[model samples]
Target: MEGNEMKAFMKRVDYLLVGILLFSLGLNFYHLNNAGTNTYYTAAVKSMMQNSHAFFYASFDPEGFITVDKPPVALWIQTLSAKIFGLSDFSVLLPEALAGVISVFLMYILVKPNFSRTAGLLSSLVLACSPIFVAVVRTNNVDSILILTLLIAAWAVMKAVDQKKLGWLILSVTLIGVGFNIKMLQAYMVVPAIFLFYWMAVKLTWKKRLLHLIAATVVMAGISLSWAVAVDSVPASERPYIGSSQTNSVLELAFGYNGIQRLLGQNKGTKSMGSASTAVQNKDNSSTTNTSNGQTPSNQSAAASGQAQGTTSSSNNQGAAVTDSSSSSNTQAPMGNGAPPNFQGGMGGKMGGGTGGMFGTGTAGPLRLFSSELSGQISWLLPFILFAVIGLFAEFRKTKKFDMRIKFAAFWLTWLIPMMIFFSMAQFFHQYYLSMMGPAIAALVGIGWTMLWNYFTTNDGWKSGLLPCGILTTFLFEALILNQNSQSKFLVVGTVLVGVILFILMVQRMKKETYSPALPMAALLALLILPLYWTGITINKTNNASTPIAGPGSGMGGMGGMGGMGGGARMAANMGFPGGAGNIAPEGAQDTSGNSASGSQTQDGSMTPPTNQDSASIPASAPANAGKTMDNRNQLNTALLSYLEKNYDGEKYFLATDSTQTAAPYILNTDYSVMAMGGFSGSDPALTPTKLEKMAKAGYVKFFLISGRGGMGGNQSESVTQWIKDNCEEVPSSEWQSATSSQIQTSFGRFGGETLYVYKD
Candidate 1:
């Protein structure tokens, strides 16, 4: 215990922590140069970097047509990165990657003081190799920065509690506010835990604590709303329409769409503006319904008008399935009235389902975090953490006295429990949102490990029993998950075997009345093997940037075939268990109804899923953008850009489309801006007839590209198409044909089949 010995020990710890951080950096930064990782966000970042105004508004297009659906703080960081590094796939994603790396070090700092250095290192290591954490930081998602900011706030709060410094507490609250800017209300999920920890551990009187919390709340609100207030102050005519807000209001977007609507999914009155438009566009009661239940009005109009116009065979073929191109070589019959709905709306009613039922609990419940669909994302070690939490509580109950360490455990639990409940029952969350649970799980694992080590190394036979019981239980849970989801028989058998061996070794060591670091180390290392292996797969394999979950049997953009996990559409079909080959639901392939991941057919719609080969051809980093209704295929077609530039001179907007997905690649590829007429879901009224007429008449938009099927559901208006047919002449597919790559054409459905039409009014 001499000073020199302590210094040497500390040096080794620092080196190990530094090494862990570097390892995380390598995983995140390894395939940095891949393009279009998540074109939705990448394109938005590119657009934001075009000018300061666009940057401030977080515009998804260069001309400030529409901002992205989320808050701009995270986008601001990415914009700054792109500005410094110059725009590329790597530049836009660098800030988040670096944030993730910093978070690893911060987790260690937050844990080491109250717990042993061993606990802190293990915690940091677990977080560093977390599968979802690795996947999220490597993408353009706002979550990486969001999670990091929250961790910083957590650290600040912990320090304030330990040191009794009011300033540290203030800084903590301020950082949470910053986190709110990064991801709106999602960051406030930890508030209850923060408040409780402060109240319990700050040593302040009840009155002082209440007043301090009020002040912190006020500051947090002021900081969180700073940008939202500024954006809302702008006139709708001046700023881009708030992309997903029902009333084009930032506040409404925050509290409504991204807030409650996300938590509740799509409820009666709380549907997103996009969903509303989709409903209107796809209303079944329309006059355009099948004239005889076998012939849709739109199809009738197409057939009659086509022959009247002396349509060529190619154009006739084009009318059936391709974009409204003049050169259609192959012809097919128009879709009959019995055709299935073209587009699925409102995530297929998955968002706002009822709460998980009672103690039995439904999808959104206390156990929702451990559900089949969610567990693999970040819950690989959840069973252990949960058991450790129970053990910690039991120990505190026995002592009947307040321990700072127990209080810290309380804060971590408080932080995790509510969020767990919220995510469990919340109807509309994506899997990546589970990363919010990462830090809590890591801290609990560390604290629990240290506590168990102390008990087991001593002669406390009864207390030591908790270790084997917890470890064995976790092993059983993981074994079940692996058996159901994994393709690797070796993995399942090996994991179970290792558990048995570790159990025996620990029991033997305890009985011998000996304390060997080797036995405990072996046990802990064995526990880590499975999750770390999965994390490695996540780092090496292609992730479906759209769904953004990591594990075996991921649908699209995954190494689906390797494990027993089903890949691609096959996994989508099975839907039996998490990480199973059939688990993934492609972005637009199915509604939230747990329906089969089969293709939706629109009678005349041009959209198609990428062929398996085409999907395989996608780079490890490139996530295809076809979910929902937008298709982001070959955005950088040199031929298309040159053609648009040559023929559509002086146009303010280079191209116009009905959905954001269709416009993303074009905006990203060209210096010119592209307008998404209806916003993300093709339901926004941003480009009504009047607006389109005004822009088209003014030469603001010279070319309109009709690449994919329309309708928020499958009810695209014939009037919209009729208006274009009446006012504009169809540009031949030949001019833009060069823009279609064989990769896109042969895999036609993959990128909405590149059905090109250049319409000039």
Candidate 2:
């Protein structure tokens, strides 16, 4: 081939790759008009834009009263974007959207140097269309940014090893450190992968490698802990109380709540995992013991049931347990005919245990990713990738020294194996966290495909035979997923067609005794059809950006009732907190995956079903802080806001609530600060009785809003609720409806369906 021909060939590949990138951008930005799905972060973005203190502290409101349960880095980007773009939902989410596009590009570049351009493009395509990757990127969740930063970090380290450049190594760890600032300890999962890649691929002496790693670790820790240290350095009184901390220490939060809890699955409800069926019995025993406190067993049971039904009850039985007992109980709640009660019109909540351990409940094993709720979202191509990985390792078994491809493959395996185990065993995690596995999965898929392509096109009988077997296995797994989740015949038909095509292609290649490159490509394309279709469904069917998921049915493939396209289903009406897949918010708390407080035990390891949320809009698993659009649940009760503003005109806080949920939307929509009296999870002791008394006396706080069934915030939420109940007059919902009576009311009735009360002098 001549130089000009080679240049033209490269140009076409570049154009095709560029086209794929644009396609990814389009998918990410499709229906991107959400005013903010994750309102917890949305409110923070608003507050940060309005108040310098809020920006610095990452507070949930402009007054710097309390921060979100996360480090400020991810929100900082959104805040800056909102500041420049005028604080719309689109502005806040733009950074993540751009990150999604760039991640696809980076994945391509990452793969291209070691493999063919075709392999690079295919990997990028896989990453781009990955359901959860696309879903999270399109929402306000911090995972997208975290994923991007980690990808950049991986790229940097890869370059570091390739060029033996210390600068690249520093740059790599620094980016990982930045990711730590975005999501704290969750970002460090990839550190081992990075260190190993560098160690294996770099031509450094063993001692020098160890020394270099030590220095990298130091830099990484400094960057990772800098913000936590800074926030902790400030006196608690001067800065917003760190949200989601048991001891009000971010450092403690780093190690205990977010760090070890994730690794060991030492969540609140974990102790009861063996006894999930006996939650009621356990509650009964506890109630009997506490009977001397004037609470009868019947009353305790009633309160527990009421709490389960999202009625006006405060006590959480489980505290910070990770097991979904409420959801589990709801699952086991017998309606006489063996049917569970429909809290909403959605599908009954399916517990993790069933025949084959559907959602990782009954079992925690190596194969957890191959089955269950987590499987569908991120693990679709995982099995094929794993087979490819094994084949690559086996094929290269004779080589005594590691090559670039082998080293790269090892790095990805290092990345995938740990996370797979973590998610498999961890009692608490959301499906979106699986986004971390995207790059590794994509890399393996690319490497595997490239190898198979080479093997199939060549005259290697065993390799050719294995290609067909792997394709068959992947098709069967996908078909099983489709059958389990969708009522659409498209999946069934597609599966059959894929099988037929695979059979024909395999026979043609094997009979001719020669490899046809197009046949393998055709098989690969056929395999992608179902996931691509599912991705399309996710893009078009997803209404609530808060808990974005991919499937034929709305909201994480929960419903077989609303199969196929165009369901016209509204998104979740008003999810309370941090409500995404597997990331269940504690009762009356926002989703606090990383923070200790919100991640703390709810009374029971159960989720309150979002009342009247569109079944289509909620994820299969309701996350804390389920999404509510500005026009939907987020529209502040104008009359209520006006009443507070007018009556408490000069007050520092317009209103106060037990948790951020009751306050965040008001702050975001009204651009007025409302005090989160407890914190994000209503568990933070940010405001004690003394603090409240002082604030009330100072006229800095007033107009307390008692929203819904307030949590017994351990004692903090209960204390504040009691204080407001004793000192404040109940404000009827009718009076609260003075402003939006003619407009659209929230799904529950009006203005978040929260009962409001104003503090009286």
Candidate 3:
């Protein structure tokens, strides 16, 4: 690479765009070699890379006993990357990091044609610097990839409008179907926007538009269901059990577990775990009662003990109460469905018990997304959105034909509004899922700023003030969020000072009748400072192993990113908030293990669920000084791996455990198959006594780690657990694990505490 070649490359390079993308690449791949991967999903990647069936099903382990909760498309990308690059933290996370960068670029290209290049850059830059967006991009979770797919679909929609080609429209919706496979129903968040834009912008006849729209929907549905239909059609015996489904059916999963349950905030499906037969769809608008300052009662520390166990099922309820240790009580509604906040199959949500709403999203209302619990993640530029939306349609009367700006604005609004409503009212959702609202926010802010500025310098009207108002209002909002989080006063002061100074400068320039772009550019940079720094702090840890939030102390991993970075997750817990997993059992239900799994008590004295999401596993790379954090948590033990590998009996599975959490470490650490008998949460009813007997007789599993609560499922799962205890021989932990590490893996919660019991014939 001589200077001449470099010079030639530089000349062809779109440096401004490349520079923004490079910064995004930096954020997404900054510590690629060192950062922790989400252990839960990463295990699936490891397993999916093992064989064709595992690959097709996104198996959580090599044995193909069960699939990961989400569809296989995103994991397919990661598995391919891991295969080509050789599995490692960096290799598995590359697709998402790259997707993050490419999505930034897509934002630019998507905006530039309809507006100015600067508008595109502004949109791209906002997205690139977004803390939550960067956080998700840096993880192995499917959200970023899902976002990338949706953005590509957006580009296709643009093509259909620009060219009036029905083929392009079809391609657009088809890509959306691909997105559905990446993230289940989340991909549909943008579908309405797409259809609205196409119908309003395309010049086709009304009948043609109707017919074309119907065809597009058909294509979208077909593509969306392609994998699900194929997987579901296969005999239950031929494929892995669907991870989150109650009935072992993909459609049920799509419409239920990953679908409505997300909105309902309950892991409802079975009558086994509680008295209710379905997920509690009845919304309890009563606030989750907790201690003042919004910390969970009895949770007095956020310091890292550095333990890393995955979310546990609520322990067998015995109706017991103890002093000095009980999860905070919810007065009315209980969001727990006997699983952790990290949704079944380890899809994590808001990890901490900070109350805004049921899941720390603030009480459901129009102001919900604006609440402190939610705003810090995605609302820095929200004030600008209103003015932008109104201004976007301002030029509609200037021409009889529909404007591209108007069309795009309508599409973006459609996308943002539905998502806003969902995030505001929906009970069950992770903060990172808010990334869906980001592109629209960025696009509108960019274009709206452009519109406002054009009017500010050239017109003498009320619209001219919107820019300064938007900037100042955003400044106030950022300050409020900072103040609420108790963030650095320096950052808050910086936001206000920077915003006020920019507003003044823009106002001065407006008076002077000069339209130089410097003020707007400076304003954009001013807005980016805080989210950028927040993104920086989040670069080291996986945030929460499952939830993957950004910002200072945003390391609560309900799905157990806590599983990967035990130290950070502990530090987050030490931040003095806890919520995520717990369950209340039926009265008189006998506890086989003799433990109680209950949450806070309500006014009527009935119990709510627990919300503690600290991890028991930490990356081996974590700072060694985090202390003896691995005791009784789910830390991956090399010695255990060596023992299982060395004691091979030509069995199909190296080990079988209660659920994926117990098996994820072994699957990710080694090539051997590890079976999670009850699937993701040990509640899927995936195995039966007959199946276990056949596997045992066939020598398919030589060992069973009966160390945790069997599951939150029915008689089938419990019966299988009993059969194992009765039929198999329990090996002493001293023979394999370190003497001090015998109880080295708490399954999901304290009620489901770790107790090492290895059973084998």
Candidate 4:
């Protein structure tokens, strides 16, 4: 390559990256416009930008009560972008979109040495335009940062291998550390892949290998530990709440909850693994009891433990304690009594024990069937696995002449395999978490594609190459068409017809003189881009036209649906809160008709069900209680509210509710402080009166509002309600009236038959 050629190549790369950047920008703008900031991460960013003038970092709550859950690296970039561009939805998401584009460029650069430029371009294009990648990039999430970090780390490691440079090794380790800082523990998963690459490339003696490992570990430790040390130096009061730990330090939260708890599920802070285990056991016991004797085992023991302390029953109930009681009527001997069995020693053993040793048992057939449903979720890993297999085959076939890139790919596979196995064994798995492997997957796929192309051309197999290329071109074209249809069916059909014509023209050229694979791939890329363009336009219009709907059922008028009752789905409506299509009453509003609205049925239906105005939405709010009648239910509510106000400082106190907006105005508008109650739902036996007492003791929550009639339909456990009645004093009607007057409440007027009970510790 001459100097001018190299310059031209670089210029082309720059042009490609810039084009991707603009494309990503348009997509993100559309998504933000359509969804108006979809996930919690985006909401957090928007909140920060709205409240704090600085963008580098913004607290989730205005009081700086909770810092953003994710690390500040991405947020800092986003904040700076917003500052320069002027904070709009687009500005807030610009950092992720840009990072996404840079990742594509990095992919091209990283793979260019191992594969042809065409292969590199195709891989980059696949990543840039893939629905999954584009979706992550368009949203304000940490996944994009994860992708960038992984790519940079992979590139650095490859550089080290190519140059035999310790500096590159250190740099790669440092980048891994940075990834950990962004998302705790996820970066470390790449180590196995990198180490495997090294071992395959240059086999070192055990002693040298040990030394290298130590050096790499030290570098990684330095990168990760620096943040911990800085965070630990801060005072306890300054730290966010980790579990129940006295120190709210960022380090404690990161290390204890995000880092350790995520892997081991042993965080002692808020919700401990022990408690979760115990809850599972209790649930099992109740189900068994119900089946055997038509009586549910009392969850009094679990209930008494409260929020601060989690309980794990002893292993006595293991055998008899069915993991899923719904499966079979046949009773097995009790494995143990208290805690669930800890079978982390062996993956198969753990899985078997957790599922009641059902793997081979024909009786446990239903459980196997249930597990099969998750196959689709794990399918994303297939592309990477396929690439790894191809790379391994390529490396072994060329053993006489070593390809450093192949060796590097081998190392990545080594790292990826162990991490995949570990995650698979570990009980918790989600597809998004696999995103860390996206770069490696892209690299492998690029290599595999190149290998196939070379094989055909070397064999004078132009006709064979035509078939595979044609197939790939068709697949890419169809994907584009389907994606485009998401915007407008007519537009996509027209585009597909035009693409068919272009494909025919390309085929003609191929027949004359084997046209470069790049030409067809480029055309396919254009087809894909078309849909995203229209998608961007749709999102922009949606954003511009959106109107804030009142939280569900407050009659603040907005879209309505069954899924609108819960905060998550309901907030998706214009108002960004509950009470849209399905939600009947707003957050605090209750149905006075004594007809318990089936909240359990709603929850069981779907997390985000489509809006069914007739069947889903709560038809009307409960009629107002006219006379100031003090009944047992009203007394219980009043006593709870009165006790909370009298014992706790009303100004500093907040009602513990799931709805933040509804709760916020009532608590914040009035001198009283409020925050959303974060915990398992009321149905969980884990929530006890003692837990409420502990929450009050820790100043986490001051009051608990108990609606007399169930609107959403799920009721508080009998044990929880009884405990509250026995231990805490309810607010008096007179005090409730006074507090109501003091608080500039939003949903209070709409509370049909709902009773607000405030209680003190």
Candidate 5:
């Protein structure tokens, strides 16, 4: 413990941290350009880079017809990145990737002061390997940036608590307000946790604490609403229509479309994400209480002996399947509807009736996070988190006063528990949103493992049982998740074996009145192997940029082999992802819902299940932009791009389409302003016949990418279609579309076909 030795130890830790950050950088940046980009966001970034006006609004087109659905903070970062790196997929996604890397380092910084260096290091490592975290950051999604901002706030709060600085506390809340601009109410998800931790741990008079909090709250509200209020203050005639808002107001967009509607899964124009009760099951709704591997959740203690019954998986070296008897079936249930009635109104997700239920987040229930649809994305270490919480409570029970340990436990658990509740019950969310859980889970794992070892070597046999129990239980849970969802279900055995061997050694050493932390450290390393492999899958295979999810077969971008629209669509599907075997479900495809992965001709529109013997493709059959009601096929018609460019007459808008799905490819590929009439889901009532007629007459636009209400699902109005048909001339397919061009469905599934028209007075 002398200064020189301590300095050497610190040096080693720094080297290791640098190495881990390097690895994180590689994971975030590797194959990044080839990976699918959420063209919806990428197109917006393209337009945001055009000029200051579009940049400020996070406009989807250079003309600033409407803004992106969320606030502009994250997009603003992306815009600056594009400015520095130039407009390209890599530039657009660079901020997200860097954010992810910084968040990993922040995890270490946030944990090390309260916990130990060991806990901090382990936390960073765990976050770096988190599948969903890696998956989303690899895309153009805002979540990485959101998480990055939140983690910085967490660091500031730690400083606030540690240094007793009122200014630091204010700074923390101010940063949280900044996060609100990045993702709106999602930033508030962690607010309760932060405030509770502050009040409980700050050691001040309750009244002063309340006053300080009130002050912080005021600052947070001001910062959070700064842009929204500014934008709303502008006259409707001067500013673009607020995208995704029922009324052209920023506050409405915040409190409505991006707020409560998220909970109800009903925005305003799309399908009602019916609640959990409406889970669409196959013909067989009867439950038989079956575990795939014939093992029960409670019996996983055998994993301590490396003979955890079903821990032996032989299928493709996939990880082991944990058998939970509480679950009704071993089969991974495809996502079912999980929103309230009347909540319909997204870009494409059926408020009801489709298998891509509620953004493929799985049926809403207490166990939704463990559902196969989500487990691969974020639940790899979930059991560890649960056990960690229990261990902390038990170990710290005697500490009545709030110490740093208790304070941190409160911070991590508060941050973790509410998000668990939200994701478990809320209807509208993507899997990547689970990245918010990564830091808490990662930090808890490190702290919990440290505590687990401490109790294990205590010589109090009763108190020491947690280590074996934790290992066995986590192995069982992980095994089940892999069996039900992962292609690599056989990976469970090695980690279980290693943990079992270490447990045996620890017991023998305890008998001899000796202890070694190395045994526990080795065991923790073993547990991280599988998640690392999953991250690798995200780096190389996944290209479903719009709804970035990780794990085996996750890159189902072109839902029905509907190809990309242009070279940029390659950012979504055409990168040889497995799901695009074609419009036909590749011979043995099973829908994530247990239904056929692709839609079939059924009168009731109740997606039909596949035959029992059907094999698995990427797990979710309905997840890729089902929110927008479009099968996620980009099919950027280069010929169409050429056609429009060749006939360009210096118009303000090159092409106008019902929703972003149609306009995104053209916008990403060209500098031309392509107006997405209804915005993202094509459901926003941003424009009317009057607006369209004026724009057409003003020579602001010329060509219209017309589709029926079913084609692309956004604000495709009857009046708009009728007005276009009455006023414009239809362009023949031969003039632009190629003979061999397999038209990626520009419409929302089988509902409509897309046609081109010239807007002539």
Candidate 6:
């Protein structure tokens, strides 16, 4: 290409990138309030930035001691924006929105060199406008960061392959390492897929491949290990123990139980338990079978044991399993409890369970099984099928000689295979975990669409072209009809108008004397972007519904709904309360188990526990400093602080009935802490005994607040309500605590919520 032509091409690409960025910004900006807003990660990041003044020094709850889980990279970007722009919802989210736009630009640049300019443009546009991509990036989440890193890594790997540049290889490894810091071992999954693809491409001897593999391994290890070392250096008490570290806690919970455990319809550690029980059940069945056949049961046992050992030996041969005993040991706890156990011979349980007459009985909990099925349907498996089929054809045709097929194949594998293997072998799987694949899927669709368009227009001729045109025309017509019928609906009308315009352009192209293939594609790209943008706008507008507002009859600064206290009570009950209501010592509380006494029913129908029975109810006398009105700020702050000082010291009940309203107060108030156990319902004195007993044993309580108007009854699930009934304690006398109005204003205006409960163990 000539210098002027190259310059023009670059200019076009730049213009297109800017346009996409603006569209992305607008889409994300408008949809800030969507129900499916970013998850806990966004909240965590925002909290970190608010606490820490600097970008690199991210902290959450400066008064408290919780470090941010994600790496500094993304947080650093957000922190800078917050500091410079002034902290607000928009400021915190701008970094992700901008990164998302940049990632799209990078995707275009990476594809443009290998594919036609039209293909590059279409691919980038498709990714920019993908429903999932737009939704994920617009919200506050680590997904945008993951997408950015994956794109950079792909670009780096492509450069290395094309130029044989070791620098690019190192850079790619570094990016993966950084990705690991963002979310632990999740990033490492891409390595195996990338290496396998490379091996297939080069057909190199094992020794040659091993060298590259070792280099990549060392780089990944260095980056990940450094963070691990830092975390390990902290005292165990100070460490963030998000889950347990046992068969149920550490290996099972983190990897299998909480990881893929749900996929098999088991609890966090139930998969391991289920597997072990099945093994024992199989052994018992085998013994019975041999005895029935008039053969020595010992012989069958020995043979089964030998087979188990042999399988273990084979796994050991590949260093996959350390010993057969390992699986047996891990499965023992769950088996004893009659819970489903996960296979523990690394990933070897699949073979063992299959041969040993152990498979899912299909009686696993409906919710968990349904979740697992949905996860499998949406995750890497579906994308792999889509990409492999399209990628194979693209490679075979050799229409574009620029090696776009291999790059995409490599990129897809690198991101996908590792995650699939890890999750499949894990004890649990959740839909959110699959969010990482959104970008990869978007990229694949973009490329696939471009390839299909090219094939029809160039190879299959006019007949093939008519099919896409017809589909486009039909979409346009439907959109036009919807628009005319729903003029007030901005999203629907805007989408239809965009589709019609794009279809008209495509139709015009079909009739032109000489078609510029890019015209139709560009139009189609616009159609995709416009709808997604409109959808995002709608979501943001709808998210406002989540905000908690003050209403009439809401006591004390319009606070009415039970605070998170009620939820905490339910969680305590579910955990198996070790002590009786209020008498049982909490997990972190001082030991008073010996002094603690169980409760008996009172004449008023209250289950008055023996210890602190009188103190359990709110004190009748207000403090000497207490004033009549709660209108002043200082007085309110002092009263709130006093309330916290009195209430926050011991285990307190948390009610999570109103999650959306609850987060702000729980987050803002240091004196207040929450335990998310179950939903909220009106207070029932009759249910207090069992609930209080559970809370005492579990060492916590969640008091559900009931407004006179009847709060959150039919809306809550049976399991959730049952959990609350089983866990929480109700104290009827502890009502209507007085506060200065200033404290009320501070708590209500800054962190909107209705009722508050003091959780006691």
For each candidate in the order shown, give its overall lDDT on alpha carbons: 0.56, 0.58, 0.60, 0.40, 0.59, 0.36
Which regions of candidate 5 are displaced past 4 Å?
1-13, 267-356, 486-499, 556-634, 708-716, 742-752
lDDT of 6 by residue, 449-492 (tens): 55555544554554335424533543444344334323346755
- For candidate 4, the clash count comes to 53
C-alpha TM-score for every candidate: 0.78, 0.79, 0.80, 0.57, 0.78, 0.53
Task: Write the residue-wise lDDT of candidate 1 on 197-309 in tens digits.
Answer: 99999987888888888888898899989889998786555677666443456786677656774565433232222233222221221221111111111111111111100
TM-score-wise, the better of 1 and 2 is 2
Q: What digit string (tens of lDDT, one per residue) describes model 2 on residues 1-761?
A: 99999998887678878988999999888867532256677777777877677798787777777667678898999888876766655776799999999999998899988888888988898998888788778777788999999999998998888888788999999999999888888899998899989988999899988988999999999999999999788766567766655445678667755666554442233223223333221221121111101111110001101111121111111122111221112111111001112322234433332211221222456766665455667788876886687678666874666788888888888988888878777643445677889888888888888887666666465666667777777887888777766446785767867776786668676777556677777777677777777777666653335445565433322222221223313322233211222122221222221111111112332112222232232333333333331112332344565566666666777777655655655665464567765454444445545446556766766666554433323334445567666776787656655423322223332112355666556
Worst ten in a row by lDDT for model 5 = 308-317
- Global lDDT of model 4: 0.40
Q: How many clashes show up per model?
A: 21, 30, 30, 53, 51, 58
lDDT (C-alpha) at residue 154 in model 3? 93
lDDT of 5 by residue, 1-761 (tens): 99999998887668788988999999988877656455566667777777787788777777777676778888889888867866655777788999999999998888887778888889999999999899889776688999988888888887777777789889999999999898888899889878998888887789988988999999999999999999888655556666655456779667754676457544223322333223212221121111101111110000000000000000000001101112111011111122112222333443323322434456788988887777777777778666677777776675565577877888888999999998887755556778899999998988888777777788655657677567666766666766765345346565456556766765666675678788667767767777888788667763456556677643432121111212222322232121232211110111122111212213432222222221121113323423222222343455567788888899777887765545665665555777666554443445556556766787877887765322112122434656777899998867775543323333122223456789877
Error of 4 at 388 (Å): 8.4
What ranking emerges by TM-score with the best candidate at the front?
Answer: 3, 2, 1, 5, 4, 6
CA lDDT for candidate 1? 0.56
Name the better of 3 and 4 by TM-score: 3
**Looking at candidate 6, what is the lDDT of residue 569?**
21
Question: How many clashing residue pairs, candidate 2?
Answer: 30
Kindly give the stretch of ten consecutive residues in candidate 2 with the minimal lDDT sum: 297-306
Model 6: lDDT equals 0.36
